[model samples]
Target: MYDIQTIFQTANPILNQMPYPMMILNPEGIVLAWNRQAEKTFGYCAEDVLGKFIPFIEEERTYFYKDLWQKIIHSADPLHLESITISTKKGEIVNTPITLKAFTIDNDRYIFCQFNLGSEEQQDLLSFNEFTSIRDGLESSFMMLSIDQEGLISYANNLFLKYSKWTPKRIIGKTFWQMFPQTPESSVVADAIWKSLQNGRQWKGEAEKITKDGQSYWVDLTAIPIFTSAKKPSNFILLENDITDKKRLQNRLEKIAYIDQETGLMNRYRLEQIVNTMISENHHFTFVYFSIDKFYSLKELYDDQAEQVLIQEFTQRMKMYFQDSSMARVSIDEFVVLTPLGEWFIQGFLTYLEQHPIYINNSTLPLSISGGITKYPDDQISFTHLMKASYAAIQKVQSEGGGSISSLTKADHKALHKKSVIEKRLLVALDKKDLKVLYQPQLDLITGKITTVEALVRWEDEEIGTVSPEVLIPIAEETGLINDIGSFMLEQACLQAAAWHRKGIDLKVSINSSVREFRDKNMVKQVRRILEDTDCPAELIQIEITEKFALEAEAETSIIQQMKQLQNEGIVFALDDFGTGYASFRYMQLLPLSQIKIDQTFISTIQYQPKSQMLIQGMIQFGKSINMSVLAEGVETQEQQDILTEFGCDAIQGYHISRPIEAKEVEKLL
Candidate 1:
């Protein structure tokens, strides 16, 4: 029924496309055909084997051939052998697989023979012993899988089945994602495998996969794509090894980054992360920053061993009281507590803390905290702005004598930054000698003549311009710049006084000195040097100290000694702003004979405040009794001047008499 010409046409094309060698023969055992592939593979050409008995099947296998032909004739299908031995044209033997067929065409029989791929001799490939060793090594060392081009599993090695806990039957034909079901991670792996095959490349990576038991494990995977001679992908050989333990260790290492090792609390780094996350979520929260007052002093008293103990105790206390809040230790004594509580609760919490105390080291230390409270999206929307604003408010509160909490107002923020800028620029301004000195005259009440001039410092910066003496003085004192400024004040006043004396000016010059500068043991020598350098008689230079610093400088024996030494050198003293400070009669009685200046507050209010008038009269009587001069300052009007003159006040200084003048204008007064 089948045509011989049609069968040969179809069969010839198929055989030539195969990578195997084959020959064809008539049923009479005469060679009929030999293809180019068979000739090349067996080291024989088509001319050598075309009409010859098909070599390699061997003439010696005549009996076996007869049996094979008989079987082929009986079976309607092609007869196949999975493995066999065959001789090449050079008489070399090969380990191979073969297929044979017999067909009847025009009442004659023809036979076809073919050999399987990679069927070279056993010696040419791996020897039997080496093949067995390699197979054992692969099974023990790797979890291997064979996936077809469609990402469907065709085979899984014994190790893969062991770790995945999947039977061979359950794993085959399943997509990679179906077996793992941990996508998109598993899907990610499948994409990587397919991409490598698509580009004819290999792929390797560490990935997470789920087992049949639904447990996750990490593995290092390596995929190799198998391709045909035409560069078309066929299957992928994927190898993996368990790396779960290593992954866990890496996770722990990453977790350590967010933890504070000292106190077992979240650190500043983690705090920033959470705050930014909450900002992106549009969550409302209050950032409350608290600092313990004089924490450094406490640390010194407690010693190094107690540092960690105190921090741990502080964190525990915060965790206990603020159970619902997120607290982070940003520094040794600083913490940021984030809460969703109302402003009333925050205010109430601060009040309660003032009443209670934290107990540690067998002593109850008072818990006084200065805090800054800022609301997210209310005070600032960015993490940096919120943090900066909160801390700035706290700094302002602490500088004004702590023990309180406050929210940042726009004005407060501007004032704080202004103060900071002034503080920084003042340092340079001082170095550049950019400050000016002006003299306010002090008039003698009885004589109606100017008796002395008080030197006052003024500063006008090129950039910030015109810093108030009230603001600059405090910053100078806090930063220890007062000593240098005080020294400059002394030298300039002495020089000007000497210049006035040269022009026949008989008035004295008084320079204000800070309590800190007054307490220095070198105060006497510094004044003496200035007077000597200026060639000004010591009697004309009076060092004026306010009543606020009355007892502070006097408390130190060294300062008391220096004052007495300078007083003996004809340098007089003036108790400036007398009524404003808490100086007792004892300070006045024990001090060398000098003068007292009534503060401006009493003079300004004398017309209405009868008590202030009485206080002023009593002060005059007391000064006279002590044989010291009494001076009234800020005599603004005739009535106030008349009252002071009637009270026998010896000296008066006020705007009514003269405004503060520059050194060039001093000649008119002289």
Candidate 2:
């Protein structure tokens, strides 16, 4: 057992040096030691907390201490918890972050909890009194409100009243979530807020809300729960920051990336993206590559300006006919259309084109339109090959005397039927339990040990051998089968991690989720159910979500709430494939992420490219600034690992560590 006198003599210097409060508690939850900072923070001297069970362990919340202690004692790992409740000597409630590490000295159990609450000076710097200063204060646009335990708004800041268009009379009694009309529809968001607040945890996320004018807008919201001295819920402080302008800018960028300025049609790049999506989803559509017949001669007949006008007229005509199709200009006279049309429709389009003529300046221009048509899933299924096949048919039409539509021949149908059958079977593969979950070790750069491994899914058909994830993952996303696959992976990963934990390994397993899973309304409940079914500790599971997951506005609230709930249960998130998409800092500010995995594209060239190294530096710095772990993906060489470590990457995963291995095979490495 630890001798109190000896412990003080040995730890006095270290205890006083800590800037934040540091308290030592025994296994029974009795505080044994308190530093100067602790006194300053809780308004309690060392004598006040020492020999006392942590001041306000509410009877209902007592399990929180038990669970936390059990996790640390069994896992032998230091656990950091945020938004813990505490009561000061003055009988005031405070929500502060605490990190607890279990230790044994001479067979005695103790937990050292470091309270990372900032100094009193810092608190004063942001106190409510100063915030009351209108003109120079946090004046601004952010709405702030305080909600009492009864769910009534007890206080509203100036900005909150201004935005609600209410004089204190109308706003005072309204609940925080009911401030606007849209709040009632977001039940998932409201439940999370109420649960987290009553439990002494903070809830934050971006959700659309209705203003007094009945206009909808997005805001970054945060609500911190405050408790009374008796450990009963008192109220919550909520802050809302308007992010409409940021989203508008992102929407503007989305347009610039996909639309063609000249023709008001989807650009070539966007057209390719659409084609790829269609192929992945196994959607059948007709692809037509056509050009005006003898366009050079036709353009020479008119001046340059007149030629431009004629081209615009032809596009207008095509637009009139292809209402539901995606069309784009490939060249001066070449245009392509991807339509969900059949042969009958194509023939009708051809006939319609023959009956009409391009009229400019009240003069008829006799121009023949020829098209080559190929069907997805029936002809060449690969997007690029489909495009080539359509062009070939177009050439065939021009050779056969123009002014016609030509269909894809045997050249485009090579093995098409077999591939379609295979795609159909692959959808049911997960249900049959034919897919495999493999693990690839990730090394902690600081510790130089394997701490986490990503769970990757693999599939092999009885008739067709191994299927590449690259091929099937996209198909799964498009066909809405990813949710099934994701759930399976999560269950398997948890089961495997649980097995490792049985061996006292404390391994963390990473699972990837598609945007579709986030879109599912029951995602949060689903995740909790899987954890219970597998008996997997939430702390050992990490979910990886990508930036593409943020494209849809409606799904944002669900995703953010689910992530927050799971994270509060001790699950961590990774911004997978970072730097590949929009890479918005908004996600970093709002999402409850633990790490940022630098995309391989940036790390692969870091050894030789100065720009790549600079980008890596910026990412690492950004992660540090936001208190997130920096991990590098696809590190294949010692030199690359060294460079990443030199720049402060916390962990790394790639072939350099080891390719994904089967669960049984992982034992040898362990």
Candidate 3:
């Protein structure tokens, strides 16, 4: 089955240059190839040995040579005979040492023999039979393959065929690289092996290989380059042990410990490991964090099975696009990727999404993703700090309404660090009841007396000093701490109003509320419980809401119902910053609003800007026509206050009257 002529012809030049005799023979002792050196050593020409049995071994030693031939065939490793008696054409007998190895090509087996022609004084005799016995007893337990200097498979043992599922005809004569699947990693291994063998060095490692049917298996391989007397490599011998089972078990354990089962990507722990490794090596790379926008909202629409399918497809696309990067799934909707610095493909991915939208059940879901980038060894020195910095960048995008990408800046880092500290301390402050309330009074234009006071929550931390509501409120809401702060505001405002009523000082205390507060179904009950606990008259308490809350109330009927229930209990609702937001008459009609507060933005410059005066006047007239009172804010000067008074503004609250004060100061004012 083997192309014996081709193998001999390929090795013809190298064989002729050998310093010692070399011969190729079949299992039955017939000569196949007789090199020039073999002819000189045995006194036989190519014509005499061609297709013929050996005529060099003595008749008395013929039985011993036959026994040695059988040993070589059964042994996977090369065998050597210490001495053999040979008779040349001149009838002169000589003792020679030789080595022999049995090799298979296709279904045919051949023997390669090399003879040492020098005398005992010139060459030291080795225990060839003993060495062969030891090798046959131990090394034959593993599979073997022979590769020529050109790296083609000259021969492979039955063991290789057994484990590789490859027949002799399918494997023989092929280059070593052909046995492996075509991939970057496999190519790298093949190149390394070739280089090492060419340099006359032994190569040893564990390699994963593919079988005939595409199943993967692992092998512990040792390749030794076989050299000629010229100190140049002629062929390589490979000894391999199948390690598939052990590698598979190791892979399973690694999968459980380092893989995200949902998407088959690296998990958070694995990402941390890789990042730490990179940091130790001082390898500069960018860490990019990705978050799917409104992921939970989309997830709620699908069942668990469909969600998993969607997630798999999403990650598959990522793998294809970012083929060179390392990626990990850090959370349910968050993923991270590590790439060379300045080589991020996120912008390209965003563009790709525009052309290809992910669909489910024939419907295009509103899918958008955001990314944040941080450089390694540039932004942070450690993996934990790097991840935190990247997350801060992501938070910036999320806070700005998401669906975009951003990189961490020095300024952003400082601001985000401050925000984190504030958030943590704010929790402690709430627990300690360190937050206090101040009241800003509203003066009735006709009565010339304060009629209502707006309760504003203020926080002063021992570590962070005073944190403005503008900075702290958004953090509280984002962190879900606004519910606690809102509840505190309602309780304190009700208690203060009750105290003032008991003192014969009639004042309606208004407390601002966020739309998020009403997300809790127990908000109405909580307010009622607070009023009852304080024994405050419902008429003396007012809940001021912004136009944003009013806009949401339009769609969320439950919030509007809650407002009406509170209003029915004799509590009042005023739409604050009326002219500053959407200012939709629809929400104004949907909600049971007692009054509309003209935003300070319009009243602040009403005295100079006639357009402001016109808008203010129109707001007041509209409020009165709708049977709702009008109040103007930020009346900082008498001219501004008098202008509002002239415009028929029912009430005004600002510094022009008096700045916000504590409950004691309000008592004195009353």
lDDT of each: 0.75, 0.76, 0.80
| CA RMSD of each candidate after superposition | 33.4, 28.3, 28.3
Q: Which of candidates 2 and 3 reaches a greater lDDT?
A: 3
Distance (Å) between predicted and true CA of 592, model 3?
A: 1.1
Candidate 2 regions exceeding 4 Å error are 1-354, 357-412, 415-419, 553-555
Residues 1-670 of candidate 3 have per-residue lDDT tens digits of 1145644543454466555687877777777777788888778888887677777777676677677777777777655567877788778788888767676655666777778551122222123345345655434577788898788998888888888898989888988998777889999998998899899777887787788888888787777776556577777877788766445434433443466655778888688889898888889888888888888888898765556666777788788777889999997788998988373466677777667677887877677888888877666667766777888788889899988888877887677668778988999999998998999999999999998999998988999999999998999988999999999999999899999889898899999899998877788899899999999999998888888888888999889888889999999999998877884789867899989998888877777888877778898999999999999888899888778888888999999888989989877776
Question: What order do candidates take by lDDT, descending?
Answer: 3, 2, 1
Top candidate (lDDT) = 3
* Predicted structure with the largest TM-score when compared to the true one: 3
Q: What is the alpha-carbon lDDT for the whole of candidate 1?
A: 0.75
What's model 1's lDDT at 251?
46
The deviation in Å at residue 148 for candidate 3 is 55
TM-score of each: 0.50, 0.45, 0.53
Better of 1 and 2 by TM-score: 1
Can you tell me which runs of candidate 1 are displaced by over 4 Å?
1-288, 292-311, 317-370, 373-406, 608-610
